[model samples]
Target: MASWSRLGRVGNLAATIIAVAGCGADDVPLTPEPGVAARKVTVIRGDQTYPMTAEVIDWETRPHPQVPERGMAVHITYRFRSTSSDSSAISEHVELQACAVDGRRVVLLCTSIFNGSSKDCWLGPSADPDLARTADVLILPDQMYAGPHAGDPKDHDGYVPPRNLGPGDQL
Candidate 1:
């Protein structure tokens, strides 16, 4: 089965490529709370290797369009924001360069770019509970670039790595 979402503001640039899914509502929740996997990834823009927070901002689960019998399709949307004062480190076209990993092994990955008119780049991840095991989203630093270079997006890069997003953590 494949995971995908209808295009939004960014047209082909907008990607909803979540891979967290299950055979039924029991295997995976019909709706995982938005922002569950609010995590950080290493973003490299030239000499800079900085932190960028990624969050499952929006998500939905439905029957797989191709093989509904296999299970359901999980569509999750995530965005990237530079954690440092220099926010442009994560910008347009950067989301297109990403890899989904399970441990040290790099699994299949494909994402569409949707910055929604800002540097806070959004990408949708279709889900298959089996694929969700590769829960961690790693950034392709070499491919990522700072933005057209502008003011940062509020402060979405608040979540630090090695620790899960908490109630006290500001998003």
Candidate 2:
């Protein structure tokens, strides 16, 4: 009986360890609390790097023609700011950039572009621009993209573009 009890305890301990070890970073709750500012993320493209702030602003699990079952269509509002002297370091096509959520990367096509120019740019869905507020929706992941010059045939000063970096990969 004593040996049997000890074996049962060991089994329980092993089970607990396995359960804890199974949890990945994505398993952690990323939901942001209300009235809190979303974290800012940095993305690097080409010869420049820019800061991008994004929030889950809104989400809908409603079945759409484009989305299949068990999939959700999320609405995210984001802003991009250049860290370099040349404010235009960010491309106007930034809205089409790829974003990572819960370790899944998705491309958010620019539905609307606001305050677009050189220094500051904001992109989001066209339906509601004012809904964006600083409450926690989800943890923002660093956006990544291959710039326009990624595979240009013409070399600039013998400079070769680096390999395409996936979402969250830094320069």
Candidate 3:
């Protein structure tokens, strides 16, 4: 009889634990949906030009589904070139232009993130889709940037920020 009572108490405790866990799950927030699918572009260095794969990394979005309200806007990164000439361009600043899948004009800016470094570019508060134009291919010197997140007020000043490669490597 004593053993039966103990078993009953254990069952009650297990049920209470599961109920608490289920209730806590509801408190968790939802991750912000990714803004758009990754877009590809070509990278140009000096006189050489080639097709390259890149994706935009958004900072406003949450990293994990359990942790919402953390992620941000979508951005781009160097992926294909890493195994090719892209990795060799490390520390060498290059320019990349974004074109619509249909090859239409989008937006252009001096980006140093092409070197496959942690650098990231944050779209400023004034960003407008209508005004967005395809980036002009050009060469420039290496530039040092601040943090990779959009929380920085300076990120809106037309400068691309840098972030750890691992954290922002994926779409």
Q: Candidate 1: global Cα-lDDT?
A: 0.40
List CA RMSD, all candidates. 21.8, 14.1, 18.8
Tens-place lDDT digits, model 2, residues 1-171: 999999999999999999888879653434322121133444433344444443333443222344334333344444555655666645444532322223222222222222253322223322222212212223223232234564454642322323322323321
Model 3 lDDT per residue over 53-169, tens place: 344432321123443244322233333344355555444444332221112322322234444455454332222231133232222221233225424554543344222221112
* Stretches > 4 Å off in candidate 1: 1-39, 49-74, 84-93, 102-104, 112-114, 117-137, 144-171
**For each candidate, what TM-score against the reference?**
0.34, 0.31, 0.28
Superior candidate under TM-score, 2 versus 3:
2
lDDT of 1 by residue, 47-160 (tens): 445466544454444454666566434455566666768756444345323334455444434343333433333222344434444444433333232344323446433221
Q: Which scores greater on lDDT, model 1 or model 3?
A: 1
Best by TM-score: 1
lDDT of 2 at 80: 58
Worst 10 residues of 2 by lDDT: 126-135
Note the Cα lDDT for every prediction shown: 0.40, 0.37, 0.36
